[model samples]
Target: MREWINLPELGMIGLRAKIDTGASTSCLHASDIQPFQRDGEDWVRFTAHLGTLVQRRHRCEAPLVTVKNIKSSTGHVQSRYVIRTDMTLGDRMWPVEFTLTCRKTMRYRVLLGSKALVTGQLVVNPALTYVQDKPVLLDISGAP
Candidate 1:
């Protein structure tokens, strides 16, 4: 079973997610990632291009707290973006830390780890889709 989700800035969408209780933080296939400083604080900005030429840009800047080294499911060790953001699935919303990485080769660009889906209900039927058949979610904001 599967369901539809709406991100705070991205809007309504469908994604192939693995409700793994083993992982900690959710990982997003993000690219062109760069970090900068503003007003003596730290902020990281990057592009999230789901399935289009244009990249949907998102900026996260908080008191530069911590960056952890994590290993991906594929057994690759890399540095990822860390931030606490609001994610809404069904009628529930919570804050989650999502690391930025490139998932162009994977079926689902965004991987819903156990940490984010911990409290939400689980749907395991691969043949299922999202709620209201929302258009595949995309972040169309990075085209020149």
Candidate 2:
């Protein structure tokens, strides 16, 4: 079902989400992403470039897993890096892969695709917001 989502790793405090079945891999808005290191492991940090105003920026971090050549929504081939992060959409909380890219032209900074919402517990209702009354928090204190 359609539900609310908060990407705490990306500092998304409040946002309504629509569960999309038409998409394969999920996508998120990201830019100025510079891959770096901490404690000798591979990692990357970026800013979620959500608005036209450059002054407003939110920091996002993710551990670099692997980079792959994938196709875009418009059927163009593009290589993108995959990063794992916790996602809280309603009462459900889990880790998901999000393709980092510039989504300045999109309406939402994030879009939950089929891979993230398929094969299990959700039944999306497009006519409604699919509200879930629960406290959503990131379990990042022990995250690697």
Give the best candidate by lDDT.
2
Tens-digit per-residue lDDT, 23-56, candidate 2: 7777777788888988898888888654334435
List lDDT for all candidates, in order.
0.60, 0.70
Candidate 2, which segments miss by more than 4 Å at Cα? 50-55, 133-144
Model 2: what TM-score? Answer: 0.78
Tally clashing residue pairs in candidate 1: 4
Clashing pairs in 2: 1-123, 1-124
Candidate 1 lDDT, 52-114, residue by residue in tens: 344444543333335768887799888766755666666566776777778777666566777
